[model samples]
Target: MVLQFTDVRNQSHIRCGLAPMEGVTCFATRLWFSLTSQPDFAMTPFLRVTKEYPWKRVSSMYAAEIFELKNAVSYKLIPQLMGTSPDDLERIATPLLSGAPFVDVNCGCPSPKVVGSRAGSGLLEDREVFAAFLEGLQQKLGHDKFSIKMRSGFLSESEFPALLDIASSIKMAQLTLHPRTRKDRYTGRANWDLIATASRECEFSVVGSGDIVDFNTLNTLKNFAPNVNTVIIGRGALRNPWIFEEIRSGKSVCISRNALLFSLATFALLHEFQAHNPLKLLELVKQGLFFTPCLTNENLWQALYSRLTTSFYGTEQPISHLCLDKPTFAKVKMIWHALRSGLGAQFMHPQLLRSRDFCEFEREFLNIAKDYNDLIPLKYHSEFDWIYSGEKRNEKQESE
Candidate 1:
């Protein structure tokens, strides 16, 4: 299975992977992806390189913290770097890939921020600069070890063959294509037709991304895009964490309510670990939209008010008071609304502070995160490290 990176392994062709999406795919989710689904290879979300501070701190500010974790779980964690200049790329690349293997260059991210900076799929418009970026990456990271992720092209599938030619010339370890032009974004159907064409055109293993959500969709793509080597999943992975397991074993997973709750609690626990500043904790918790996914459905306001302050707070009944209100995953509009309003943990699970037993491990663990440094730092270099350091500092200050 491509999911298993060992070259000589018995399993073959079974490559289940998670697509990298900004603000969504982080180490916590990466852990969930591998531990839960066991994808063949996971692509680190795009980390933009700027000339701001060289390799001093994180690029997007929030990007590097998630990418570089001390105990980065267990699995093949592939880091992706996106930059316009070879210098900026090398500047961050040195530290980003310090002890990492299999770095991937992103030419596929369609975010407006990415395109505005000319780092992601926008680079597809200029093949020369694009090739220059890859050649430089190859020179810095070596030829066979680095991979590249890209969309078909800017306008049409015409540029895909050229894109493959460039990837081939660099001897890229692998190529993952999200078969839509910059024009379509996520609106149009993924150009599986173009993916089929490029799979045959390229010598390297090609990974197909776009809309491989469920077991049926995964199976459909096996025949539909025979040319591609693996299937890459994005939003679907968030909506259904068991995607990899379902695809690999030829089984469909019924996402249970308990499953969603477990995911929510544990993810908050992980974010709380990395949290140094309260706002940071709140922000990362906000990203865990997939876990408690149901604020935007019907009766939005009622759900919001309930999730925030129920019998869990004030002169009211115990939160168990409204125990029956928390429905099994029916229509998740309420969860959706909360996520969009603010990616703040305070909003998503405001009652967490009130519950003595909501998530005990999280409560004790989050006690450490309660330090201001753990959330949004007043002045700290490594917010991730600050979580532990802040605890020590708080203790010292108290003793003093």
Candidate 2:
């Protein structure tokens, strides 16, 4: 049941976890995921530390946020920090650990801003700095409470052996490897062969991450790489929140159209509570819908789109109208403000916009989802559109 990859290697049960995502995984997000499908562990988005800021106040604020909201969910929550300096690590570790039981150092983030700062994947490019940082953590926090989350390498597979060599000597609690170079940046295949090799060579417990969406894929990883004990899911979990529970149950995962719709509604409701401004909430809703699988079903997609627009605009207006006409940020903000002040209230579902308790909301939605699953045809009837297509979508559309 424990989330520690090393500790759970011999355990009879498997450990599934939610990976950290900036802007996407927040307090409300963690709660929604836990309620829908409990991942054994969850991590806060990587908190950036620099020579100027060094994450002093921001780290404490993050700690407080995690500590305050974690009680509402079941999973073990860990705070993740990103930095190149050992001093930054030494400074943030204690305050962060004060709020959560464990702190995960983020050495795997591939964002250009992070890499440009000589942190995240950039750390992989500097062996001496990375070693000093790890040694600093060991000296300050001890290996029992702190862990590292890293990629296979910075630019190539060459960095993996060197990283593992340094990592094996260090006494980290656990290590989660994403098995992709910084150059990969979520593009080609995940290189599970590298994962298997790392699992065999590394002395510490290693968790495999990248492209794990369902139980079948999880099983594939387990069978292919017996050494990897746990798996961390990122974008896959966001697309289908129920995946973790389905994997845990060892059942064939089937996400009904209604299920996807209900999850979207739940996300909007949850996000409303945590977001500071209406625009931020709208952005999150747009992002969530963009990632969700319901776009594959027209009925469900229309229902969600209607509900979402109505929730924001307080009317039955088409989203395309706004996207095509009122595309400016200021216009959208004005529309949101107008709706909040006047007519928007009447159109939104009273139960959702005015939802009080997350648990109660989740239960009610679960029932609605069950009804949809029973009433609708199990196979999605809609034609797949070009909106949710991948990187090659533009080229395909042009050719057509």
- Tell me the alpha-carbon RMSD of every candidate: 16.0, 10.9
Return the lDDT, model 1, position 267. Answer: 39
- Give the per-residue lDDT digits (tens) of candidate 1, residues 302-347: 3433443321233332222322212211112222222211222322
Error of 1 at 222 (Å): 1.9
lDDT (C-alpha, whole model) for all candidates: 0.55, 0.62
**Which residues of candidate 1, in runs, are more than 4 Å off?**
1-13, 57-72, 277-400
lDDT score for candidate 1 against the true structure:
0.55
Clashes of 1: 26
lDDT of model 1 at position 113 = 75
lDDT of 2: 0.62
